[model samples]
Target: MSHLLIPALFFLVILVGAFIQPAAARKPYASIPVKNLFSYIEILPPGSRVLLAWDYDPATQGEMQLLAQPILRHLQRKRVQIVNVSLRPFGPNVAADAQTMKQWPMSAQAAAPTEFGFIPGESAALRALTHSPVIASNQPRTSARTSGLRPTDTLAAFDLVIEFSASFANSQEWVEQVASRTQKPFIVAASGAVAPLLRPYQQTHQIRVLLSGYPDALAYESLLQHNGPAHRQRTAQTLALGLLLILVLIAATRSLLRR
Candidate 1:
């Protein structure tokens, strides 16, 4: 039947394309956004405190994991104190995976970023951040290992805030509450679908750096001169899309011949 045949054929094409690596001849263009991000990240002095908000769950891990990996590595390389907080339940796990995969803290003495765990109330929690920095998971800050994350410290103390979000609502919360109050610089690694939605804020310069989807991730990887999972995913995606178009043309031609 045509129904079964079409899906089977499409699956076959994608299977073949996944194994076929895309050509590397195409020059990867690093965009102004990525460059701006690099500049912002580079300007931070060593030991600067950063608030990293993970607002997406595991559902978007495939897209976000690669994007966040390089940035985390770069931050670790700079020796900044990273404080991770999450609105989504699964986000902390993803952040842990990213740190482990990237092998951050190159030195044994360097401690991993403090994980504040998940905060339940989205808008309310963000509002609390303005009033009280330690909203959820108020662990003791006694250890020098906390990298100066004292219980008394407010969110304003952080040098910068970077949010990796998959949802428009999550990004909006950051824009409205976090950005409005602190007046601190913000960087976002957003899912492609949500990137356009956040552009208006970027236009006004509320968002300092915005990176969307696999292409931007690949571009960042290229800028880092480190070929990683994003490169592999891009190759597979390109090859599969190319093959899919060819399949469509062939199907159309065959239908015309039968007619």
Candidate 2:
């Protein structure tokens, strides 16, 4: 009964909280990382080319999607030409969905970001991007031609590399094979559990920005002053956690009185 009651109450609170839209101002520590991410995107001039790697699959999409959406929206607002690629098979599809789900005017939509589909060879594929960008894409010849991306071009052509991943291997591969070699600034948006493992790289100055989980998401939303999916997720998380903690305390008090 306690188990059922606690979870039922939790879901009830979360369901109610998810509807509220306002995201409170975040603490200084939480705001710092989000501000750094925004600053990187803000520095690029309009129409600068950016390579965005969508590295997570559907199993982790709920969290990753929420994290990626605001950044994509921010990039679109800046009028950058985005070339998106993926290592995982379903990654292109996930990236497509995140773009489609964003609230942008059909007319104001920046040129639809180019999708390079999926690259099969992991570290080898990433290395190829630095040397032979077009062939590494595996994109149809005509599509590459239309985008004006020559086979001679390399990853160095892009102004920046931003990766959203749930996999540590994907993140590590990017750092060791791509960013470290190309010497281009890189950013990562990772699931909270995986963020700690990747933090050491940031400390060593291998990457620029790292955003992890709901707290960071809320901070980003506050920075943007635009509430979206992350706000909903944060509300749900906070309400559920707060309710569960209260329930535990009540149960302890009741047991003490009975004793």
Candidate 3:
């Protein structure tokens, strides 16, 4: 009873504070990370090759899609060559969507995005990308695997592989299977829930850039102020946090006065 009551009262206090304070604004989820990503892209040289590793599905698109699209846009803006691969079956197609594509500042030099259609088997498939890539993006120049990729194509000639996944087959797979074997840089953008596990990878440098949640995204948005969804989300988040603080203070004061 105490556990429920005290927390509930605090929530009520927070609600009241939100009504009174100007900080309760709601921002989009993508704003924070987008800004951080923007800065990262700004540092990269033009014409860099980036591999978009889509590893989630339609259900989680809302949280991840916006996050992924803006990064792709920023990379494309810089004329980055993108090679899209998916350990998840739906990842490759999601990577191909233009809504995700439009954000990039694509240039004449940008290679038409490459889709290495879903890797039929993750463990073995990921391992294959390390030494040489056997993957083929279903471009018309090639259709069937025979017309397409060889074992030599596994991890050839790419700069960085950005992994966007929402599954147990996580950054670890990219690390143990691909990055470890090939020594290629692996960047990961995963949901908050998976952050604890990913942190060790980042600390040890198994993954290069790791973004955990809305907080990181918001921080990035705050940094760039790019006037994109990330910025808008920051505004909303600022407002919401302000309100929450106010409510906490009010509740504490009320309790003290009563005592």
Candidate 4:
């Protein structure tokens, strides 16, 4: 038997599986962070400003879509001022959301939460945003003729900056760039793969809230007595991980037996 064929088959299988749009993306579950976001908005006065950061790229979007969508919806519903920012190099896009990024609208019920746009790196951009007079000085996602909104406008006006990270910066970067510079409140939502690394920051108050993927999202949903996409995606995600572990174990066992 050819040993290479086994791993080759795995890739082939995953590619085919990708086309199927696994059960998770269709129905995602809400985690604790979602609920916490819901509650935070509940207590805040109407028309408050919030800076939303998408820290990861396409690789992590599927797992966190459940968290992102509802978070956007809740903010829109609460009439909160939203300033969308992305740290990921290719993480910004607009497709006619409930609230268009075209113009900031606070009272549109059917309105989707508005997006600001992508800045640059975490350190330089965040620092500039905290102090600069104009935001979106360098628009990575939009073209020159499209929208000319400055991220600086949103950053200066917003009260909070929530970083949805993937341990890309260890939470220290946000504290340094946004928190320390402007002394504004910032929160972090990290993937389970990197949540442990962020624990110290949460413990020390370097970051305000910590929302780990899947399970944490579910907890938040429970807190609000609301259920959403994160739950379903997490279920499928859970199943997928379980299958991968089993496959890994079997392969290890077979290799040991052969040895």
Candidate 5:
């Protein structure tokens, strides 16, 4: 039974940690990338149009939604007009579900996001968006929300471009097809699995800000003065890691005593 004790305790710790909620107010770790992202959004003038690309699917929705919630709130507070578009087929549904889950509060003066639906053809579609925003969108051109967008106006029409990316290639396509050509401030909130691959673009200044993983997400919430889902998950992760470290030390001490 002694041999099985540590493994049992470890699993117990994980089980407990998974349900841990945010307790005390922990200061979020300082992160430049997250801060830069906040600043980019902070500077946008009211009534400025922003192109928000939801590029992730249900597979990555868990992490992606946490990242998007705070961003959507910040944009609302800034009172920018958001135009949502997606590359993946399921992207629009995911975006809608996230909004529904939060029931995101909006001021009367703040306009809700105008959905442009899914744009197919990936890189080709993105390239087309650079030439004409309305032409690339799935939304009807006759709709009141998009009617204001003139044919001559391209990606440059939006003051900022933000993408919640699950795949590095999707973000890369945006950089090459749109950001480079339009010279707009582009930000990407990518999944941790793919964030490292997207860092080079940030380093090269092609991406204005790159936020990924729990750390950046928590840091961003800190910047916004909001304690969100990331905070709770991060707390749980810390607890599990701490418990594992204690168990390891205990096991090592017991072995030394016997020897």
Candidate 6:
């Protein structure tokens, strides 16, 4: 019973922390990459065109969506012309769901993104986009038509390119095919599992901003001055980790005293 006390207490603490509200006044530590991402979006003109690539599927949607929501909100606030595209088949549906959940007001709905839906060729499609932005006529459209994406428009036409990627290969393809060719300001919000592999691109300056994992998401939300889901999740995570550390220290002390 004595040996089980620490584990039981730690579990109870985590359970309670999940139900508690995060302290609104607590400031999140924003990293340099997160700050750079915020600056890149902040300077965009109201009508600037942005290419938003949703490259993740439902398997990684849980993390990808949390990272995407705040960034989407920031883009909407900037009032940029967003052109949505995807390399993954399930990506278009996921992007559509995110847009629906974060729908703009009736007045601003006219300015919502133009969905190009899923582009099937992956790396080959990205290479094509460098010269032309048009998707195949057979591809399904998910949203209302917008004006900027024309048959003649190329990848360079967009002011910025942002990709929320789950796969290292897909993100790498974008870096190699589109971003390197167009020389556009490329931003990638990748999953924690894939982010370390992408660091080389960021180091090469091919990716202007790279945001990954819950810490960066929480930091980005802090920079936006919005307490969203990341904040609540981070609070719970911190509580659980801190409690575990304390329990470990207590157990070590007890063992030392017995010795």
> Compared with the true structure, what per-residue lDDT tens digits does model 2 show for residues 1-259?
3556556556655654553323363332456778888888889887788899999989999989878988887888788888889989998999988987887663175766787889999999989988977889888766665455788888888888999999999999999998788767799999977899999998988978888887677677666666778776766766676677667656654655555
What CA root-mean-square deviation does each model show from the true structure? Answer: 6.9, 6.6, 7.9, 10.5, 6.0, 5.9
Q: Estimate each model's TM-score.
A: 0.77, 0.80, 0.67, 0.63, 0.80, 0.79
What's the residue-level lDDT of 174 in candidate 5? 94
Predicted candidate 6 versus true structure: per-residue lDDT over 170-256, tens digit per residue: 999999988889767999999999999999999999988899988888888888887767887877776777677666656655765
lDDT of 1 by residue, 1-259 (tens): 4455566567766665554544465547889998877777778888888889998888888788878987876677677888888888887898887777875336343446877777778888888876766644544544324766555667777888999999999999888988878767889999988999999999988887899987778787777776767877767777787777677757754765565
lDDT (0 to 1) per candidate: 0.78, 0.80, 0.63, 0.59, 0.81, 0.81
Q: Looking at candidate 1, what is the lDDT of residue 76?
A: 73
Misplaced by over 4 Å in model 6 are 1-22, 103-110, 135-145, 235-259
Clashing pairs in 5: none
Clashes of each: 0, 0, 26, 27, 0, 0
Query: Which segments of model 4 are wrong by more than 4 Å?
Result: 1-37, 94-114, 139-156, 234-259
**Arrange candidates by lDDT, highest first: which order?**
5, 6, 2, 1, 3, 4
- The true-structure Cα RMSD of candidate 4 reads 10.5
lDDT of 6: 0.81
Report the number of backbone clashes for model 3: 26
What is residue 86's positional error in candidate 2, in angstroms?
A: 0.9
Instruction: Indicate the residue-level lDDT of 216 in model 3.
Output: 57
Q: What is residue 112's positional error in candidate 3, in angstroms?
A: 3.1
For candidate 4, write residues 103-135 as lDDT tens digits: 324336532335546666667776776765244
Residue 153 error, candidate 4, Å: 5.7
